[model samples]
Target: MKQISSSQLNREIIDLIQNHPEIDDFEVLAIDLSGHFYGKRYPIASLKSFASEGLAFPRSAIVVNTLGEPLEGIYYGEGDGDPDAQFSLIPGTLSVNDWGNKPRAQIMATASSGKEATFFEPRNLLKKVLQAYQTKGWHPTVAFELEFFLFSRKRDDQGLIQIVRNPKTGRPDSPTLLSNTRISDFERVIDNIIEACNQQNIETGAVSAEMGAGQFEINFNHHSDVMRAADETCLFKRTVIETAKKHGMMATFMAKPLLDQPGNGMHMHISVLDDKGENIFNAGNKPQQRLLHAIGGLLDTMPAAMSFWAPNINSYRRYSGGSSCSPVSLSWGHENRTVAFRIPLAKDGAWRVENRVPGADANPYLAMAVSLAGMLHGMNHRLDPGKPCDGSVENGDEYLPLSLSSALAISMGSEVLIDILGRDFIELYCQHRKADKVAFEQFINAREYDWYL
Candidate 1:
């Protein structure tokens, strides 16, 4: 990433303050391991100095679990005294917080501590992976398709979540794949969400109703710079949640928010470009050998990368559900959604692979980082991807880790991931996830009593 000069940032901040006088406050955000934003809000008076001076939070803040609790038995948590972690603003992220009630602005920042960038930070991890491509004069153009469900604010007596009701007819929403009527029902809410995304500089493309009731899929425009694409994905999630809240609905990216409903997924589409700005995955409308090699690398690394894809316990539930789109096999095929990696049918320069294993709840930065790393490994080793499966294939030659514990165990000793993502991040991630697993196990859910009784 290019660094922004101090003078340039000063001028930009000055212009922002002058132009948006209604913005009386600003929120600086740093993405955590769980893909949640952690930061403090400051008054407009401190915006300028805050930019140069930066801000500080506990080092453990970036490594917290989904519940926002610091993991035990790690240097970031109880093992080491939680020290102050510093953060510097990421250039080009400052935008108006249009979803908020008051006129406020927000910006994303990079994590650091004592003059060194935090190795375990998800964004920093992605930067490390991108460096490998940078050294080889290869660039990745990437986009993410996010699926989510909207629910009513109220819950049943048992605290189970209920789907959103149509405001016009007061009827409960039902699953209707690609129904224009469903999309029309939520037109005002969807329009507001898109408007908010536009204000945040997030380029949103198609918006369609999905298979789950109150579910929708939004497509983000592709970016030549993979880092910027990941950054916008993070911001887009926040924008959706806040914008939905404003319209009296609750949007959740949880992997399995409802047991009986189709789960949310975050599918990634990526294509590599050579130094000459040519798509290396295809040549003269035919798939290149390098594309197959990349698929092989993704297949070999999928088990190890599974922990990152399905980061939470509930994420595993998505794979078991009867959803054809949630791929579990190490399979790849042309225009097939049932496989882990699908080579979409496209024109010469538009050829790309769509990775469909990650849940919407996974951290986008880490997920994309591991995916790109796998491609690099495949191309470097010239690995062969076995024959592509035909229509409606169930299982592949090998299966992915289905449980969080199993995924962690496979990733714990993965030399491929360690070499690509560094030993510190790999070990810390495993330890943190294991800690979360233990915490999850200790909890006794209602299902346990219902079954045993």
Candidate 2:
């Protein structure tokens, strides 16, 4: 008899079950530092009970690297046994995955204990920074533009990654570079990706062909709630990967999947709203103190935050000038793709700043946390970001930690960053990244055999 709000209606797992009876299975997922989600699938018959109580996943899930090897001294390993943290499902994310043979649904969940958010969790870390915004009566709106490559299992004669074939021509390459016609090559899977995002309420904006043979970019609309934006961004990446697999193609979010091709990147556009719901970043012709301080904070912290932005070793390979729009310097400019942070051209209230530091492989939750925290730090410290760069930045500008190892080292000693994202997360991230680097070092590459063997 009572009408429910759209959001409340979406959260009704029981209603979802009744509506989509075909969905017998559901995937409840949570992400680690590597942006890899781990969860168990369950039959829909137990959906309601499980949704109410939530699910418990290992705390080690947060500390481990891409290798899934756990950090040695973290809370997950420091204790005699790994502790379990119950994470509740994110409302409205119960998306129906009718892509493959399995007619299943999936939902994104966040780790939390009772009413308090687990500090170590990446999603929770973003929530903490959002709390800082809430305290100051400011709202941060964010959107993600993610670029990725579509590769078939087949490789070239040189063992190089080959792009997916054109559905129309049956040719294994994109002839029209950065053309919408190029999308026709992989139209089936691309359309599937669009449909999946729409079903998940991810508000996907545009799809465009990128410089890489198989690379494409998908844009998302802005969400005023930063936490929800982060969650949707995370889910969106997973959806892209999963749906691609269903179509017999591999979608890679690796920062630099191919050495000869353009690297994939995750570019985030940010705008803050005031108490009256007005975009506070609309600085008119001149820059406002708040906006400048925000930029200054980002620049000040950009070097240390590099560890999260470029989470893997391959991430740094994308930082070169030759790699289109992959910015490496701590510079901001008006609609400048050459700079790490750019103020896009828009109407007064529509103005937004884009942080191009994050690779497609970055954990959206952690990256957004870094961006929001930098904005807060700038305001709190009243810092100043200097003039924008005239030409393309080398990203090797002074004070920037360019390498993965160096970035991790800076992250280990950064008290300010620790205060922003939490010392425990910073520590685990550093240790785990070191292990990841070490693993790569211990192994000899085919190229190494060519040169030094």
In terms of TM-score, which candidate is strongest? 1
Poorest 10 consecutive residues of model 1 by lDDT?
1-10
**Clash total of candidate 2:** 2
* 391: Cα error in model 2, Å: 3.2
lDDT of 2 by residue, 1-453 (tens): 112423463467767777887788888888887878888888877666666666778767767767777655455655748767787777667778777686788877778633432667787777778888889899898888899888886778877777787767878776355697887757888889989888887788878888887888888888877777888877778889888888777788999887777788899988889899987777676556677788888888898899999988889888863446788777988777888888777775577778988999998988988888988898899998889777766546768887999899888988888887778778877877787677667776689889987
* TM-score for candidate 1, residues paired by index: 0.96
In model 1, which regions exceed 4 Å deviation? Answer: 1-5, 113-117, 396-398
Task: Give the C-alpha lDDT of model 1.
Answer: 0.86
Which candidate number would show the highest lDDT if scored against the true structure? 1
Q: Per-residue CA lDDT of candidate 1, range 97-184, in tens?
A: 7666677888888885335538888888898898899899999999999999999978999998889998677898989999889888
lDDT of 2 at 38: 81
Candidate 2 Cα deviation (angstroms), residue 49: 0.8
TM-score for all predictions? 0.96, 0.92
Clashes of each: 0, 2
Q: RMSD (Cα, Å) of candidate 2? A: 2.9
How high is the CA lDDT of each candidate model? 0.86, 0.79
Task: Assess the local accuracy of residue 226 in candidate 2 as a C-alpha lDDT between 0 and 100.
Answer: 77
